[model samples]
Target: MTGDAAAVAAERVAGVAGELAARVTAYDALRDHRAVFAYTYFRLTSDLAAGLRTNNPPFRAPEWVADLSVSLAAAYFAAMDAIDTWLGPVPDARPGGEVLSADLPETVPEPWRDVYAASTVRHSYVLEEVLFSMMAHMSYDLPLALRALAARGDVHHRIADFHRMNSLLASSVDVVQAEIATRYCRRLRSLDRLFVRDDELFTSYGIRVARGLAWFNCDRLLDPDASAEALGSISRSTAAFIAEFRSPDDWRRRRAFQVLRALVPSRRQWPAPAAPVAVGSSPG
Candidate 1:
């Protein structure tokens, strides 16, 4: 995309972001993060559909990027709902009438805010946005959330809850992809088949990697001196990576073999249907 076209796309993306933020404030359903995620995805779905009809996507990238966003937004929405449904509500870190125990409004942890804010400015690739989002959410937001809420005594339960949410996201991969294919990628549906394998790696394996990063940061957040430094370091690293990480190849080979060889499943099979595991269950 040329400078002019990119600017136009960025403007559209910013509008989408702004519209979503405004909806969160206005709509009661979007008052919480999880529900807000659902609203964001719902609106994004509508915008993406409009873009598809007009042939003017905000990112000007492939439909896969939009599909990826759809899947991610769905996962986030589902995870939040699943765990929060079972555990009840978590306090908004943002300032309101409720007094927060922390000094700040539990804003998006360092690099997360940076990465997400710069989604339009940083890179052209849709996957890059995904990468930056993963780092921020897993490394910064999740840990801060743990620290800001989850009582010390219930830390284990919260961690389990996090895993449960992550698992819910992982399980919903197919459903999200199908929705994207139906709604966002109708024209590109046939070509999208070639990328089907890639989406699985991107979503399911991606969540596993994200969970690992979250665990890494969660441990740091549990410690006083390390939490801030660790988050800052992650922010710095993500900043550097986003600025420097690029190539003409569009990360194809990278995606083909995204996961490590050791982590590959042994003739894998999906788990059977089970109840939404309760997040507030007392750790045995």
Candidate 2:
């Protein structure tokens, strides 16, 4: 894509990010745990859009990164649409600004289904919800998004840009974590020190590991000789990882999560969902 085209794509991504931010604000107002991931994603996309607009963009191939970002975001929104279809609409949450689509997917991806399903259970930990959402998006959707870009004949040379996103993501972690704490769980900020591994799990080490695995999966998907069985195996492994994290069977991790759960406010303690707000309005 030309420079002009890249600028347009970046603007489009900004608009989508704006819409997502609006939704996240609404969800946060409702004390919905789903907001954990939505808010994080909104920040990442918003940052990417801003980076692309800068004179000295961090990425080597801004256009390709913009396209990949959009494709990956589409997967998340598709999952949200599916969740909305399954559980009815979130109270007072409506799409505003640049919306992706009015149509919902016929079937949600299994990994996403698992994430959303875990989200609905009242007992689920805030940290787990965040991690589960990230796992689903990064581990499952990212490779597919990369594969789509490869199919378009643009991704082969953009691997460096893809890797560059890790730094951008790392920069956003502190900001995202702070926002989540202020909006959802006030205890989250300090809890990380209490549970150091949990902190690294979502904010740093785990993300790099997941992204590395995603690129590997993308390479596999791009292989001309790759088989359906191989793809299925990848999907199963991703799903299994999500499941294991969702409810850690190991005594130590489970016990740690249990302690973490007690440290944060329970779902019932949250204020009830507020009345619908006007589109484009900021959360109070």
> lDDT winner among the candidates?
2
Q: At residue 166, what lDDT does model 2 achieve?
A: 73
Error of 2 at 191 (Å): 4.1
lDDT of 2 by residue, 1-284 (tens): 35676577678778768778777766667666677778777777776676666623556667677788788888888877776675566565543222222222447787776666566554565666677778778878988888888887856677777667776666677776776676566766554345445445476556777888888888887776774654775656645765566457878888876765666545322433663322222232
Q: For candidate 1, write residues 1-284 as lDDT tens digits.
A: 35454444434443444444443343333222222232323443444433433444333342333333333343343433343343335445333342211322223334543543443331122334344545555555555555544343445534443454455445554454454333323432354343334433347677666666766776776778896887676557655555444321467644543432234321211112331211211111
Candidates in order, TM-scores: namely 0.43, 0.78
Residue 123, model 1: Cα distance from true site in angstroms: 7.5
| Root-mean-square deviation per candidate | 19.9, 6.4
Q: In model 1, which regions exceed 4 Å deviation?
A: 1-113, 116-118, 121-127, 181-201, 240-284
